[model samples]
Target: MPFTVLTILAALLVAAFLGYTMLRGRRSDEPTAAYDLRVYREQLAGVDRDLARGVIGQADAERVRTEISRRILAADTQMRGEKAQSGPSSVTSAVAVIAVALVLIGGAWLMYHRIGAAGFPDMPLSERLELAEELRVNRPSQAAAEEQTTPVQPPKLEESYAQLLQKLRDTVAQRPDDLQGHILLAQHETNAGNFKAGYEAQRRVIELSGSEASAEAYSNLAEMMILAAGGYVSPEAEEALRQALERSPDLGPARYYWGQMLAQTGRPDIAYRVWLDTLRSAPAGAPWADAIRSQMDDLAFRAGVFNPPQLPVASPGPTQEDMEAASELTAEERQDMIRGMVNQLSDRLATEGGSPEEWARLIAALGVLGDKERAIGIRDEALSVFAGNDNALQMIAAAAQQAGIAQ
Candidate 1:
């Protein structure tokens, strides 16, 4: 505010100074005809003196007088014309000078008010950085952020699946130290919008993991915490992301979250750099890469990149013909080949139980084949088989969701 006042004052002073100078110059102007007439009189007197002193002949003296007399008559006529033409013009000229001064002062104020920072002092680069750091350190805490956040709606689930979810929670509670139990609980609870419970279960998973924990485990815990806090990165999430990055710096999900945490802490410069590096190494159709791609333009602009480079594209995946060549049974026909692989896998799983992933994959493939009833039956069986293994159950649940049998 003070700066604005000072600016207006300075502009006013300059405008006033210019206007006064112009008006004063105009007022001090003497009539040009009067000056010219005086000079002619002096020449006539000089010619008389020269003639009396015999400095020139009488004819030369008369010729000089004639020229002087002509000039005097012209000057006298101009003076009378000026007196007639010079009345209200002086006042009009003064008014014009004042209007110009007013316009200059008002224009300066208008331009400054339009775009200038009126209250804040000038910010140097170092001061701006310091301000960003201050904002980082003093930002809202996780609980506070959550208090103000509007929660995202959880994925809808059928009542039967909800009952099963409750049973799984009960099962996890009965087996407090079961690593798989907590993993499953965490996944379901988050899906159910019970993020508080989800993050708690996730924390237990991390605790149980101990030294053998992979970077993915830490990242999962961070992701759960971020969701619970409505996307705010609290101190806990920061520590988790740090651990994940330290263990596996190239991990896609971990790097994505790391970039998010950095941006939340007022460091989009570092965040953009981290996200770009992560994108370069991301595999085709990576979910993390998609997340980065959606927000890349805004992040780049915040990081001072006006014309950000184009993002990396995914390479083409294998075609149906390529699949037929790789899997020999596929040569006869595509549909027949798919059924053959599914039947073979089914026969193997029926005799010798497969891993949770294999069971989930089978369930999805069955859904793709449009045998939803069969997919549901298989899903229920898998659920029963992995009742004690929550992590396995969670995987199966996802496949079941894809099958459209349950949410």
Candidate 2:
């Protein structure tokens, strides 16, 4: 109401000022013929007084009177000419003023109509802030509700595997206290890419473990939830991650997911720092290490850390052919093959002192196998070997850091 009043008052003030200016402009400045004639008469009277006082001769008085009359005539003629010109000029000036006023007023109204909430009530800052807080409080619940309503599409499975899954479900239902069974079911479901089922199974695992549940269990459940949501870091998943991080600060999966939450919430700097720190301590070849490495540069850029040195492209791990060849082997034999490969890489780096990239690869492989101690040792040796080569040393250090090997 105050704003409306002020706006109306402003419009009235402008109009009043413009109208006064127009009226004042219409008045002529030149004197009329009658005023000039009066002035001439006063001068003639002064000359008469001079004659009476014997101050001037009659001839001089006549000459002065003649000059005064001449000036009066010229003034009258000039005033008539000015009057003749004033009419058209005054009309032109008034038209220009009216046009300008119309344009200004019309333009203001048009612009306001187009872009402003002309009739909306003014909201106080406190009220606006309160409304924002309300939205913030409700948003997570709304997202969770939406998630619940959305259907989970499970991956297609062979008939035999499907029957087995059904049997497992029935057995679990029958034996609700079987925590180990739930864990196995969760792992197998996740391995088969049935994330929804895996998520539910993992949730049960946490429930069964109770206060004894490890951070890994919470992190595993969170991972399944995230996968089920197709990578969405839903509020529920975020809570699970928080629980995991609280129990184990150095848990790589929790840190990675937390970093993702930070990024999502528009804190790229914090996210970058978290991911960078996590990568530094992560075991080489760890899945979390690769995930962080893949996104580190972009996150760093967003965090204003520009032109960071590029990390070496990760070497391919076990190929499909390798996996297929090992498929026929027993579980123990498969483990032996992987361990042998890791040892061979380790031995080669220690004996041959390979390129910085090769050293980095080996360190990452060790990290992936959860051998942080060995990874750290390899990093120190690589650093010593590449002491004179700053670029190579940096690459080796970065690879080791990403693998979560201690500096």
Candidate 3:
């Protein structure tokens, strides 16, 4: 039902209760005088019975009857007066009651009209509040218009890739001096596994950036070379990595690739060491660290090597003896301490830069650590660096066999 109607009904119920209470009291205030007459009649009967039984004199009985009749007439007259007064008042009272009821209903209707915009019949309070909020945020903007616009179809991935490649080619032709453009092109080619194109692009970037930016370009080129070299590491690839490491001993890419070459040439211990050292230098999220870790796990699984799967970026914390010995360590103790220190250095190379010598050192460490997977990846990276260099490939393969890694 409508709120107004409910409110009116409630008011009427209250009025009825009050009216009943008032009217009920009126009955008590103006009680019937007939009971007084009955009492008077009973008293006269007693007087008559007394005279008949000779229990009282006739004079005494008559006197008591007269007094009772007089009191009964007086009470009857008062009751008539009260009735005459209340009868007219009841008419006004009833009009007042009806007026009060009409006023209550009208007030309820006014209140309902004021609140009727809330759509109480259908919408709930929560929905009404939400609608109010929407009305308040009525800002006009181009973004809003765009949001309302329909979506357009996008090109397929292959078509998009082709378009991007064409744009890259055009951009490179038009803006030959843009080193970033070349880098982007190289990245795209690398992602598409177009190692030749990627290598050429990286070479251009290296030329443009010169030695200053050559390290990054070299890293990319080396990665692509590894992909291009397949399983055969070559001497030329080895020389390129060596030069990169020579320029920057902390060169992570060169170290990682060289480690792979070592593993491929049957030098498992050397390859494992390279990865272990690389891990020490590599940051937590460095791709080299993750790749090396994966390679290590694979190698361990294949070769029955039990190096920890996912070693920390540094060698596990120092041993008690190493800490206590301070300066005078035994040969074995000294080796352990050096191993730990070297592991830390290699991990730093993975993160920062490394020299060719450091790369070599990392390889030896991996061999000691027994990480075949990293060793193999290093070999693969090396072969790509020195493409067409058979000696490099042979060395890598020999190391792999020696490391007990299957072809």
Candidate 4:
């Protein structure tokens, strides 16, 4: 704090000095040229004295006197010119001082407020990293963070719909171990902006699922928790995301939330990289896709990427109706359908050598089919293909994570 104060004081002093010099410009009776005039006149007198004392001959004295007179004339002209152009007028000087002060002091303050962490003392890199870790560890829990937030207004529902929701909630309360009931309750409540209730139901869903819980379940829990806390990624929410990643590391929503958590915890550089990969691969219109897109420019700036690559236009893929139709198929039929597409993709990628996005999709598809060995091999080859490309590497790594393959 003392050093900051001293630095500010020094800046003010330098500004004062600059303003004074500019305002005082050439406004003096003894301008540099005026002083030169005096020196020339004295030299002319010295020449006369030298002649009287026989220090030089008459011709030499005359020549010296003439040279001094010419210098005096030139100095007199310069002095008059300096006097005429002497600095700005009083009003102009005042305006100039104000402008300088504003640019130097006011501008500095504005820039600092935009980017600086006010009141934070400078620390060594290691100390800063330690402090960041401590903050991550000690940040508020989901419940506490939710308590500090104002609840969002729930959307209006028809009388019949509202009553049906209430009945479902009551049913879940009575049958606390009913996983599907809790899941339905969670989905509806979250849709209605009743995030607190949504997260509560989601917690029960996770508890019942236990080891059987899919990554989507844990990721959904984290999502509701974040929404309940007014978008703050609390420690509890982060734990839910960690659990999701443990189950399926390439889980899109979980990676999205993990990136957000990293940014919140002062690791924006890593978050920037994480989001760059995740955003490109997230299915079009997913909640996290839009959220990540909205935040990428700011995150890129924070990560020192002044000119980040053009954001990928999330390509049109499967529609919700299409996905629902696929979900209706029997297990064997659906598996056969997926296997066919996966085989086609695998062949195309092998022969044609497709995009990073395609390779990532293929890897994730293999993971879904429980083909970890093929997924790992495909991941390795993909890494080799895009060895020097950082963004491609991140993409492959995100998919590789799902199959438990370390980069």
Best by the lDDT measure: 4
Task: Output candidate 1 Cα RMSD.
Answer: 17.7
The C-alpha lDDT values of all candidates are: 0.83, 0.79, 0.66, 0.86
Candidate with better TM-score, 1 vs 2: 1
Error of 3 at 104 (Å): 99
Per-residue lDDT of candidate 3, residues 1-407 (tens digit): 86556677897887787777666665555347757767777887888888999998888877887898798788788767766655436776677677777777776667777865434566675875566445434322323433454433333459778888888989898998899999899988777766657777887888898758655556667676666655334454555677677778787777888777666555556677777777777754556766787788765553456765556454334455556785687878767777677668657666775444444445555565677677666555545654676765566555555555536
Ranking by TM-score: 4, 1, 2, 3
Error of 4 at 264 (Å): 1.8
List the RMSD of every prediction in angstroms.
17.7, 14.3, 28.2, 11.7
Minimal lDDT window, size 10, model 2: 136-145
Error of 4 at 358 (Å): 18
Evaluated against the true structure, the overall lDDT of model 3 is 0.66
* Per-model TM-score on C-alpha atoms: 0.55, 0.47, 0.35, 0.60
Candidate 3 lands at a TM-score of 0.35
Q: Residue 55: error of model 4 in Å?
A: 34
Name the runs in model 1 displaced over 4 angstroms.
1-117, 316-407
Model 2 C-alpha lDDT per residue in residues 1-407, reported as the tens digit of each score: 65545565566568668866776767656545657767887987899999999999999988998998888788778777767766446577778677767765666666766886687778886885566446534445324643764556666889998899888888988998899889989998897778878888999999989999999999998898887766666678888998999999999999998888777655677889898878766664678889999899889987889876555544435756688999999988987898888887777666755678888888887887788888888888888888899899888878887888755
Best by TM-score: 4
What lDDT tens digits, residue by residue, belong to model 4 across residues 210-278? 889899999999989999999899998999999999999888889999999999998888999998888
Per-residue CA lDDT of model 1 for 160-205, tens digit only, reads: 9899999998999899999999999998898898887888898899
